[model samples]
Target: MIEQGYNFGYLDENTKRMIRRALLKAVALPGYQVPFGSREMPLPYGWGTGGIQLTASVIGPDDTLKVIDQGADDTTNAVSIRRFFHRVTGVATTERTAEATIIQTRHRVPEATLGEHQILVYQVPMPEPLFRLEPRVAETRRMHALADYGLMHVKLYEDIARHGAVTTSYNYPVMVNQRYLMSPSPIPAFDNPKLDRMPALQLFGAGREKRLYAVPPYTPVRSLDFEDHPFVPVRADAACVICGSRASYLDELIVDDGGTRHFVCSDTDYCASRPPLQEDAA
Candidate 1:
């Protein structure tokens, strides 16, 4: 009953309609972060209100929905979002990456290959790629409109000047279609390759920031890095502790309060779904 008078999911349809309209424009422009009137969801602000709105706009009777956070379908927040869709629209849900037609994700893209018919919706805390360097929303809008990204280049150059490389490890910015710079949400830089020329469509939603953006399937996406110092997506040197896999992003976990920790693949689905190296071992 989030949309009822008791809750209203923290925003009404009029605001959602505004966001929906902006999303259409973003799809048309491809990489342009269109400004919209974002609405609040019953969930926390940093959560997935933007994803919820985008889902509401496009979800139809025939679509199969998937929701993931940190790449695990069972994460509480992801499960909550899946249930929210069930409550609102009663769509079927799946954890299997192959079965989903629309995947709403946070922090990681599914390792499974997404088909051209699928749509990947990212829950974005911030859609502006230049936002960290320049905090003012108004200023960034001007930058996108004019394609003035020299500030971003200078910042990257400054990182090389001091740190010997681009210091950013995740949520790295990329140029979309040689036009607008967009944030790939907080997906590890490992996922950057997936964004490039993918068969599936990619969309970003930032509710708190009031923006929505897109990268058309098979569109170009390049991370900000220099020819001398290229970008790298970090992974654990070791395999997943539970379901051993070397190809997925790992979450470094602390076993004790002392902070002694070991790294494991953050994308549990990817970890679990990989073909076992040795069938006899299983």
Candidate 2:
């Protein structure tokens, strides 16, 4: 049941219809950014107003929602968004990646493999991959139309010249369907590989930019790189101290004032799903 005064999923029916139309265009075009009438939400712009709007448009009463910030379900952003939906839509919420029907994320994709039943909505601060290189919107759109990503390649080559490799750790540029260059939000390079031919439908929304895009299930997504210097997904060379997970992306935590550090899984749900280490009897 929806809250008393608000429409279902918070947005008005007409607004939802408009957003859905934009989303449809986005999905159809694969990597092209489709402009939409972005609406104001209770939250600020940078804190996922776009994702909230997308979720509001698509989510139904029976859908199970999950929101994660940088892979953690308990972060303030995640918790607040989860509670907001629960309050407004009375929808079921879960921390488990496998259980969620719709997952709205910022900065990181869930470590668990998503299936066809799930939709991954990313909160993008900037939708244009060429924005940093070319500030002019018109020029960027032209470049995208011509499939001219020379600027992006030059930028990457510059990184190699300075740092000895493509050192872009987050928001790495990718070529979608071999046609368009895309910004995969701010997700770390470690998660970039997961975007390639992913089973789940992926959607990106930028509220401040008023842009939306999509990568339909099984669409090809390739990280940009040279033949000699291929795209390599890098992560902390440590296991999760809590779950002893060696494969999941690890977050380094400063443990003490003396600078001692410990590593843990960024995906809290994935970490928790691992079996606890058993101690041998003494």
Candidate 3:
């Protein structure tokens, strides 16, 4: 209905129905990656085609939508996604996390607490946690069916042998409900905890990978780690240099030629919402 006036390849209702069916399967299977006939978007595949397609299916006239990339609305990919949605659906848009009914994100999760009414759609590059290790889907599926993940434990042990730590900073693998192994996407391990018992529904989609998965509110997801080394969420020791919020995950920013560094909250809404600190006055 949208593209007849604009250009070409505007997704038809049949395409929307196909995406909706895949979404239903994803929600039912939790972490299981449901294959979908992903349609091409105005934006490139890596940018957020899955997120946009999922958004297209679930959006209603009353929803408030927010889009962010690397914590900024003005980020190039975020702008492109938002423009496509605006042209197609004419949905209301905002930068405030609290005000949004649905949020689509790339590279970071919003730091503010989300409510049951909100939905989080993540743009994922790779949805399989075992892809790096096993490479073959047939083998990985058997491993999952048999509840086998000794290889994951062994990989962590090797990391300790070499790096003195796990060394994995993102795309940390976890067990959903202690039964199904799952990937929490490339968001730092610090953000993994936020997924558990969150008020809003969490959905992960990978366009290039042809996968769509979800984590319902209040579901259990535990990262794979050892008792001696333990799984450490990145930035557990670093506080935001700008907002002074210690709880939020941060992206390291190298500010000087001397290699001096600072940490900034990856959630733009969360950082902007924080009150001015005493350090800011100085």
Candidate 4:
């Protein structure tokens, strides 16, 4: 049942309208962070507050919501967000990626491909890609205005010099529409390819940072790399033990104190939908 005494989707109608206006500006300028009046949510920072606010803003009574953390629907963060939306909006919730009209995600994207009808909302801890390299916010904004990405290229080159490859496995930087450098949230580099020319719309909200950005459908998103050292998506070589999926990203788990390890699909819905491996194949 929908929670009483709270507006639909939890936040008031005016706040939702305000967020949607910010979202419009974000979609217009892909990868450009637009400031929004970030509201205080029931949850604390670093706990998907931005994503929750975004989801609440866009969701309608007809929308089907899905929440995933590190691509798993059953994780504590995912489950809590899903339940929270269900309670407040009373909208239908599902674990299936294809079924959801909007998917609020943390850390990882789903293994299944998204459609044009779907929208993906990301919880971002830090919206600025140059935050680590440049601590001053004003200078970073100036750099972005000038389209001066020399520092980012230099950082990647330094990584190659020290590690022989780009060591940034998550929060990988990308060039959006050949114009702006964007941070694709904290998703593994393995999922970076999915962001390139994605049919579905992508939205990012950084609640603590009070920033919002977007990538409209079919927008160009290229991972930053050099010709000699092309961008490569890396993942575990082992197949999923449950579903025998060789392509899906796997999470390594320690089975015993002896340090024995096994690999399973990080995407629970994708794993569950596939036929399990035969006893002999296992």
Task: Write down the lDDT of every candidate, Cα atoms only.
Answer: 0.82, 0.94, 0.81, 0.95
Better of 1 and 4 by TM-score: 4
Task: Quote each prediction's TM-score.
Answer: 0.89, 0.97, 0.91, 0.99
> lDDT by residue for model 4 over 1-282, one digit each (tens)?
999999999999999999999999999999999999999998899999899999999999999999999999998999999999999999999999999999999989899999999999999999999999999999999999999999999999999999999999999999999999999999999999999899999999999999999999999999999999999999999999999999999999999999999999999999999999999998
Candidate 3 residue spans exceeding 4 A from truth: 1-10, 236-239, 278-281
> Which candidate tops TM-score?
4
Tell me how far the alpha carbon of residue 226 in candidate 2 is from the true structure, in angstroms, after superposition. 0.5
96-151 per-residue lDDT for model 2 (tens digits)? 99999999999999999999999999999999999989999999999999999999
RMSD of 1: 3.0
After superposition, candidate 1 runs with Cα above 4 Å error: 1-17, 256-260, 275-282
Candidate 1 backbone overlaps, count: 0
Name the lDDT value of residue 235 in candidate 4: 97
lDDT of 1 by residue, 100-204 (tens): 999999888888878999999999998888877899988988998999999999998998899987777788889888888888999888888889888999988
* Candidate 3 C-alpha lDDT tens digits along 162-225: 9899878888888887777888878777787888778898888888888888888888888888
- Using lDDT as the measure, the top candidate is 4
Candidate 2 residue runs with Cα over 4 Å from true position: 279-282
RMSD of each: 3.0, 1.5, 2.5, 0.7
* Candidate 2: worst-modelled 10 consecutive residues by lDDT: 273-282
